[model samples]
Target: MNILLTGGTGYIGSHTAVVLAEAGHRPVLLDNLSNSSADVVDRLAQITGTRFPFIEGDIRDTALLRRVLADEGIGAVVHFAGLKAVGESVEQPLRYYDNNVGGTISLLQAMDETGVGTLVFSSSATVYGQPAYLPLDEVHPTGATNPYGRTKLHIEEMLAELAASGTNWRIACLRYFNPVGAHASGLIGEDPNGIPNNLMPYIARVAGGRLPFLNVFGDDYPTPDGTGVRDYIHVMDLAEGHRAALDFLAGSAGAGWHAFNLGTGCGYSVLDMVRAFEQASGRPVPYRIAPRRPGDVAACYAKADKAADQLAWRALRSLDDMCASTWHFQQRTAR
Candidate 1:
């Protein structure tokens, strides 16, 4: 099957492209290059030995999306194009809504018009907001406290309504936890355009000596380590989850919508990540206690039973592997 990946050059999207190609499917990439680089196309070819179709455009361009869908013979879409910073969303909610929400609306319209409805949405665990219980599951109540999570929630709601409307829409919303690590090849990895918003990347930069020291955010959260804790899944494992989701949608008997949490069912504190990276890189990752980031929760993890039972997918990489792979990429891409 030919699959179109919006924001395909981005971190997770690029990794998923590698997995899908290995699964005997063609991946057509579409990105605006806002948060990613076009050089990823070269790295992808080096990894996959296949120069996949790369389209430069915005997901909000309904006309462009329609043309690409028709011309590329796209059978499914993995939507990953959107602003995805929690802190930035807190400051600029309008931009998040307009880009994340508005772009999805346009993409859906084009897909509907073109008779393509198999969609695998890139949702986030942030949609669950502050967890009422540990190890959040699919049935957990969702009330996003930030604009980024709200955009994902709003998109999921729209997908649910569309699926219930009796159209042939087969959708899978994969709510991801923290996705870290790089490809084992150390060729293609999470190369953000600007200062990293995610913790793992920031920690990796500090370990790589690009950054002076890591800001240990809020060493006073109500956690074991007195800092924010999160479930960090390897990017490779998360990419496999995307492939599994696509396969689930294909083998399903009918059109419907479902959500699955893509995580390792484990939580690690900020201090834990810093220490782990230091161990992996054999570098002294100096840090200082900093103020808590806005829109951050004390602790959040996953109860990934649903995904395992339904899609036969589970995160197999360990934290050591995550940190080791990230350090490898940092070393290889050091400037």
Candidate 2:
């Protein structure tokens, strides 16, 4: 299957491309380099030993998407294009909506035009907001707390509505908790353009001496370590989750809008990650306690049974595995 991965050069999309290639499928990568680099294609060639089709464009370009879908013979789409920083999204809600929601709308339109309906959307556990429950399930009521999350929520709603309208749109929304780690080869990994928004990469940088120290936000949270705890799934595991979603959509039984939680069902605190990363990288990750950001939760995790049962997917990597792989990539790039 020639899968069209919008934002395919980005962190998650690039990882998913490798997983798809490992599964003996061709992955067509499309990105405008808004938040990622074209160098990922070269890295992917090194990882997979096969050069994939790389399209340098945005998903908002409906005509380009239509042509890509038709010309590339894209049987399915794994949409990952969007501005994903919560703080940035709070400052620029319109850009978030236009790029995340509007780009998806255009992509769907192109898919409709090209007669391609299978899709795997990159949803987030942030849609569950503050988590009324401990382990978030697919049935959790969605009320995103921020613009970045709201964009994901709005897209999920749109996909559900499209599926409900009898469009035969086979879609699976994988609500990822926190995607960390990198490929074992260290050829491709999460290296954001500027300051890292997520925790693991921040810790990696701090350990690597690129960043001075990590800001341990609010060491008074209600957790074992009194720090914010989150379900951190490995990037490879998250990538496999996308492949599982594609497999589900390809089946005759998968015909409607389905959603699953892609997580490890285990929450790790900020300090836990720091310690683990320090151990993995053999570097001290100095940190300072900072005030907790508003709207931050004490802990957030996922049930993950739905994806395990329905999609035949599970997060197999351990926290050590996550830290080790990330450090490997950091070492590879730092040189």
Candidate 3:
């Protein structure tokens, strides 16, 4: 399979490109480097021992997408190109909608024009909003608490409508939980452009002396340690989940859409993560308690049964593994 990965240079996408190549599939990478680096292409070649064809372009460019799809002989697409900061989305909602939602629309149009139907969309667990219950499942009530989540929810709705239109579109909407950690080689990992919006990177920076201290947001939540709990899946595990989704879509004879929650089915609080990182890096991660950010829930995790039953995919990395791998990448990049 010749798989075209949008945002293939980004953190999770880069890892998935390696996994896809290892699975005997040719991966064509398309990324504008908006939130990633061009150096990732070289690092990917180093890790995989195979140079993937990389196009420096955006997903919203329908003409480019069509040309690439045709030129690369793309059989499927794993869409991961979008703005993904929850706080930034609140400040600039239009950018999130325009880039995330608009890009998908353009990509879908290009796919339709080129007669490519299989798509693996990068959805997020934020679509579950406040989590009406513990351990969110595929059947959980869908809603968005923030603009970033809204963009993902809107894309899911669009994919649903597309599937119902009688086209033979095999769409897999993989709702990912908080993705942390890095590849074992530490050659390719997350490198957010500005101040990190996610927790693990911030903690890594703190441990590496790049940051003063972590602002432990609201250590008064209802969790055991009075902090928010979230299902943090390893990036490698998340990459493998994409592989499972692609395999399932290939084997199934259907023109419908399916949603799967890619998570470890376990929740860890902020304090727990800090402690784990300290243990992993052998350094102190200083922190100060602060008021809870808006739209933050006490706890959010996944059931992960549907993905296991259908795609035969389940997150296999531990929290310690997540912390260790992230520290490895952080230390190497800091040098």
Candidate 4:
């Protein structure tokens, strides 16, 4: 299948591209390089030993999307282009809506115009804000507490509505948990532009001496270690989840929208992640306890049985592997 990956140069998108290529699928990458580096294309070639066709453009360009979908013979689209930071979204809600929600609208318009209906949207666990229960399921109640999550929820709702409008759309809304780790080759990883908003990258920087120490957000959460707990899926496993989703969409018996939780189905606390990173890097990830950040849930993970049963997919990597791969990539990029 010829797949068009929006934001394909970004961290997870790049990893998914390698998986698609190895699975004998052509992945046409479309990225604006706003939050990612152009060098990722070269790194992807180094990892896959094949150069993918890449377009340096945004998803908002409906004309560009239409042209790419037509010219590349795109069978489906894996949408990943968006603003993703929670805190930044709170500070810049308009930007988040414009990029994430608006971009999806534009992409959907292009797809409708071009007769391309299959889509695998990159949703987030944040859509299920403040978990109504442990191990969030696809049926879990969703209400975003921040603009970033709201943007994802809005897009999911939009897709649901689109599917109900009598269109032959096969859509998969994969709500991803915390995605960590890097490719085993250490060629590509989560390389944020500014101060890392995610935990793994911050821990990696602290272990690599780029940062002073990690601020353990609120050691008062009602978890085993009192810090927040989250389901941290390895990037490789997350990439495989995308493959499974695409396969599911391809084999769909009817036009419908499906939602799945892509996660390891286990929660790890912030302290556990720090210890794992420290063990992996053979260095201490110094930290200081700080007040809890607003909108942080005590624990958040996935009940991934739906995906396992439906898509025949489950996360297969360990926490140690996640830390080790991330540290390896951190070291490689630091050189």
TM-score of each: 0.98, 0.97, 0.98, 0.98
For candidate 4, what's the RMSD?
1.1
Model 2 clash pairs are none
Off by over 4 Å in 4: none
Question: Candidate 3: minimum summed lDDT over ten consecutive residues — where?
Answer: 247-256
lDDT for model 1: 0.93
lDDT of 1 at 273: 92
Residue range with the least summed lDDT across 10 consecutive positions in model 2: 291-300
Q: Tell me the tens digit of each residue's lDDT in model 4 across 12-111.
A: 9999999999999999999999888889999999988899999999999999999999999999999999889887898899999999989999999999
Question: What is candidate 2's lDDT per residue for 1-335, written digit by digit as tens?
Answer: 89999999999999999999999999999999977888899999998899999999988999999999999999999999888887778888999999999999999999998899899999999899988888889888888788999999999999999998775699999899999999999988889888888898899999989999999889998799899999999999999999989988888878989889999999999999998898998999999999987557789999999899988889999999999999999999633
Candidate 1 global Cα RMSD: 0.9
Q: Best by TM-score, which number? A: 1
Compared with the true structure, what per-residue lDDT tens digits does model 3 show for residues 226-305?
A: 99999999999999999999999888454689899999989999999999999999999999999887767789999999
For candidate 1, lDDT tens digit of each residue in 209-280? Answer: 788988887988899979999999999999999999998898844369999999999999988998888899
**Location of the lowest summed lDDT over 10 successive residues in candidate 1:** 246-255
Q: What residue runs in model 3 are displaced by over 4 Å at the alpha carbon? A: none
